[model samples]
Target: MQRQLIQPYLLVLGIALTLSSCFNEPNYPDTPSADFKGIFKYTIAAGTGVGAAKRDSVVLTIGFKDGDGNLGNDIPVPKADSARYAQNGGWGNYQIRTFRLINKQYVELVQDVNKVLFFPDLTKGKPKGAIEGTIDFRQIFTYGSSFKMYPTKFQIKIRDRSLNESNVVETDTISVPFPN
Candidate 1:
């Protein structure tokens, strides 16, 4: 009777070990070394008259690569808030700046104070691949009664979990009309 009980236990343990061995853990990639890529595309809707709501928008896309898959932050908890954590907190991983072309020169445009930018969580096995993000801006520029669209450009850059800043990329000039 004792031999029978021990035999069943051994069989169960052997099965458990075999099953565990069959599963392999994922190996994540390291940090990226190449420069980040970005592009800016925009649309303009001219305002008819005063107090008319004009629609002006810009669509921005960015691409990145990281071998270690450490591009973004993990989910945040109560114990780990924004203030407590400084570097690599949660938001602002990707930096984007807008500029208006005037007289053959690019001038930086004032940004909205409440605007928030974030990086997607790309943490995965062999993270050394291309990651892309799309950002849209609408009804932010006002033209009052002007029907002409202003030429604009965008400068974008990215950062990794290790606080490494990638090379900056300036997008091609795009004309954006102001909102009335």
Candidate 2:
């Protein structure tokens, strides 16, 4: 009789464990912070351009938050018009760094071209408080590019109007396709 009861209990426990393992959820901060967390979803758009110059684009969606509502820049007109100018463009408070999985390890994607991401003006006449929103990052690549057919992820961080830097968040692994 005791053995029979133990078997039922074990079965129930096993089923519970299995169900929990299948659960997939976004990793976000329980409390507000300079930094936030979330799930990274990626999609690709192909057939952009013609012939050998065909290009592919990768789009990333980042769900994030900020304790203080200062996540972007308010630069006016030409970046050169203002003293706030980022290397290649008018990228504001956010920085994006990409990496790929190589031999079971993460390696940064390095190239001569600049690959930075900028956050738009998020605090335009908005009250300062807990802020939460989604940011999309997109990039276009030519056929046969080094990053065309690789498993990649991104490390992203942001800055507040007060110049407070948020903690960096890394995205999940996603695959982009190359020309056949």
Question: Where does model 1 exceed 4 Å of error?
Answer: 1-52, 74-81, 84-91, 113-116, 124-148
Best by TM-score: 2
lDDT value, residue 72 of candidate 1:
62
User: How do the residues 89-110 of candidate 1 rate in per-residue lDDT, one tens digit apiece?
Assistant: 4436566787887788888876
The C-alpha lDDT values of all candidates are: 0.58, 0.60
TM-scores of all models?
0.55, 0.57
How high a TM-score does candidate 1 get? Answer: 0.55
Model 2 CA deviation exceeding 4 Å by range: 1-52, 75-92, 111-116, 145-148, 177-180
- Candidate 2 residue lDDT tens string, 26-67: 443434243324444344445545554545566656666766
Global fold similarity of model 2 (TM-score): 0.57
- What's the lDDT for residue 176 in model 1? 75
